[model samples]
Target: MDKSVDLQHYYLELSPEPVRFDAVSQLTNVFFDDAKQQVFAVRSGGATGIVVKSATDGQNISFCMEDRGTIRSIKFSADNQVLAVQRNDTSVEFVPFNANNQPNVPEMLTHQGKNIIYGFVWVQERQVALISKAGVEIFQLNFEKRTLKSVKSLNITVNWFSFCPTSNFALLSSNMGTILTPVILKASTITKLPRLELGTSQGCSGRDVTLAQLYGTNAIMILRQLQNRQFEVVIYLLNGPGLAPKKSHILRLGQSGRFAMNIVDDVVVVHHQASATSMLFDIALGGAETEVGSGAVIHQPIIPAKTIKPYTLEVPSMSLDGKTINCDLYSQHWVLFQPNIVIDAKLGCLWHVLLKLNSLCALITDRFRLVEFLLQRTEGKPVLLNVLKEMMSVNYSGTMLPVIESIFNKLNCLYKSVLDNELQSQMALMALSTKSQSSKLSPVPRVIVDQSDAYTGVFSSITDTEQLGKILLLYLHSLARNGITANPELSKQIVIDLVRNKQFDTLHQLLKYSALNESKPLACFLLSLSNSDPSISQMALDMLARLNANEIILEVLLEKGQVVEALRIAKQMPGADSLPARKYLEAAYKTKDPLVFHSVYNFFQAKNVRLRGSPDFLKHEQCTEYVQYYQTLISTQCL
Candidate 1:
């Protein structure tokens, strides 16, 4: 057999049968063992298992073992040599893996019960920080000496606990307060710091408290409360020092049927229902609130389920560098969920078959997985250049440009392969996609603006009237084409400048060429201009009313001393009955024909309105006389 076929056969031999834990079972927890290059998942039942696949060879070694009670939590040791299993029965067990270059049976390490394990972290090879419902415990294991010891225990019952990266201290959150304590591994001593009281707010329930990473070195604790029978978000700081109590910054999520929170550094990413929206907040060390992005939903769901349930969905996991978020979505195939994935800010690399597959395209949604895939493919500038060219040709903007630029910059800085041609192409595409011109006719000369320059006092005092005219025209064209609503004063100023520069011809061309119909607000402004003239006004009014603009033409004629001609034209216009009553009556009076007067009177009466005016004036007399004549005309016509 071929070497590849032999490897496949070996893998097939090691592959376990697909075991469905339960029909209603969901994978409640997943831990990626980076050291061993394996993924362990615990389902709702006490089912525990590990899928050990070589990151290089793509070979599978599956292990499934039954544990006592439902598995509440699961984790792998830092070295990936041991797996920790926490059960709902308040028991904790450590399953040790032998690295003896042969198949071996795993041995259980610790079996202690206090309360359900809420959180746990392996501090080193021998020490582990474990949090339970009752409090926090430190356990030490000396494999070299074959000994395990229960170290120190804390007083307060911790709902959750996390260790700081640099110190032996662990952050603990409980119903009473949040505490940071130093871990004295040898002596089993814990020196507790001042407690940061979360206070007695109904929203600060122990179960609803969740943590999310922010942009800085801070983390946010999202406390959900039942107010008026609806869940509301009360955000608090987690990484900062203890301070006096203050009102929590409440976010009115407005009865989100379901929601999920994820922390990436100091940015808290929240996805909620009520409005299918995602929000990012900058968590500060002092507990200050700063919302980053709030609008539409940008990220796509990994598993697009119909109903919103209290289930955890793993998005792309971020790396230590805080740049890329790795994502894996299993569509119809299980192979897609294979591990050995790294999604950096600029690149995503998936190790398959000893080769790295880089993804150079991003999906419309800000899915970490897709982003990582694209980044990996385009981490080299050449790939990014090709993508930029394609995107620019199609006029795709927003997420496309940012993703491309980010990858381009990263590749340019990291890889020497990024050539000038690729960089130039990316820059050109960004300019094309994001550029807003001030003129189309008198197109302004391009002047590169440094992105790093602040836009404070950066007003251009252009001495060239030609350039000014070009800029104004570009601005107007952009407004019309993009449907951009400028401030009233700014719009008026632009129009004044255009008029002063005699750029009406350019303006007229822009109005005619706009993708938006001439009836739109921007188009209306151009039509209202005095220089727009009779022809433009007539066109605009016709488009706005979806009619012949006969009334507008008549008004123009009246202004030019051609009342008789206007009246003649008005009478011939289509849908005469649908014309404004005032215009019909005025045209009838202008015609000075009794029959015309009678028609106007009959039309107004049919519309259920009495002619209002003196019967002496020609206009008034015409209306009054027509009403009487209209009745007789109607009776005669019926007979």
Candidate 2:
């Protein structure tokens, strides 16, 4: 039986209908702000302008930017408060924004001769960077005065400034993509004054190539399509702290077809047109030497032996021998299949490759097959858990819950299969023993029994509750280890099972190893179940104390009026001593509790006397306040 659950809940269709201005109109650029739920697009040909629309409903908003010249690019400010529009006539315009999708100010324009603005971007809140044939110029926009002032300019003939999506760094590729300079705006001044020759794409010319880089790092990746349609993703690590590119990699993706690349941190994802499959690459500094499987190195840069370690995840994949592919950190034992690569969980990498894979575009069948292959592997649990962790880490728009549940179901089925096989073996052994013993006895009628009957008898005879508890505990631990906290239903169900079977010890053990944040739901559910049982309550409290859950511990202790216990827990916590003193003082004041007053006063008096002349005495501000207050209390009582 196909045990796959209905995945319709995770299905989401983002059908963005294309808008046709005329037969010759073409989409120039597109941008999406998930925060604002808006989509911005630039088109040219029959109509040259920008269009803003709702990302969800695809409804066009009132704001529009239309002109006769070619709309080169449409960029949103870093703050998304304004839109910067550039034209081929070297004229730049800023349209101030309003809350109601209305144009709030008159269009502010700026020009730098007739060189034609190659590209312009809103680098900062009030600053814009414009690239023209002459050089790169930075301007500050004054929304109040409706004008732009030139703040800074780099006088190098600029090709394009490839801005990092997440940071202020832009790869300034000028002199026709030969010289690459990484420039970042720092408090209105550009930092990192060095530039290097990266050279142009070997077989591609003029805007056919794509460049990608990240903020806070100097690694620049260039993706180019060859004349034969073969695509290459080249990583260039430069001009950063002990950072250097390992080698360029030729990808199997987009073989004789086009491909698109996206870089997030050290990982790069490529969506290929030929196979329609997504390939993930972990870009790092120094890695183990491996054969450049399918990729040939264009240039090899010698790097130091011991440098900043590269964050790499080992996948079951191979590279061509004696090539640029470095196998520095990944283990050699994990085997890579022709189309599938097995990833080992023990590989000391950031597991970000899994994260990148989640966002990469691929066919649904490919994703399903990938998950199935991992689940069937020997080290499937950890690898699948890592996948789950990546899914939990990001707010992905794709279907993930079904995949997670499918993993869970497969694990359960495996456990069940093992149990069934064991039961069947035990039944067969028992039946043979019975036949041998009954041979000497009277021959009973050979009554036929159904297979179901024998299986039921075997199951009923099983009494290994401990083994069952261990299995359940393993399943629960697997879920908790993977940070599956969003599924409160599953968590609650498991807690109920544990509590019903009086398995407090196993529950405690499971909670002990789990992360504080990830174990919250199970811990909370355990507490709720402990209301009627003293032993269960104590176990839960002990687990919470070991978890260092200061907030809940303090709340429980105070509610129980266990002042000494609460004091101990509080003292064990950082900067919590003052809490118990304040609480006891408040109790003394509110209820005229003489016992509480004396206890708090006496403790403070001893602490004050012990540290009276020491330098550390003044540091205990809470102790000082309590000492004075207690002294006043005693004096007033004496009067």
| TM-scores of the models, in the order given | 0.38, 0.42
Q: Model 2: per-residue lDDT, tens digit, 400-519?
A: 545545544544444444445566666667788464532222222112111222123321222224443333344454444443332445445545655676666655665565422335
Q: Which stretches of candidate 2 lie over 4 Å from their true place?
A: 1-51, 54-61, 64-68, 76-83, 95-107, 143-147, 193-196, 199-219, 224-230, 237-254, 263-267, 281-639
Quantify all predictions' global Cα lDDT against the true fold.
0.43, 0.48
- Number of colliding residue pairs in model 2: 9
Question: Which tens-of-lDDT digit does each residue in 195-243 have in candidate 1?
Answer: 5554465413334555332232232344464646655565543334454
TM-score of 1: 0.38
lDDT of 2: 0.48
Q: What lDDT is reached at residue 400 by model 2? A: 52
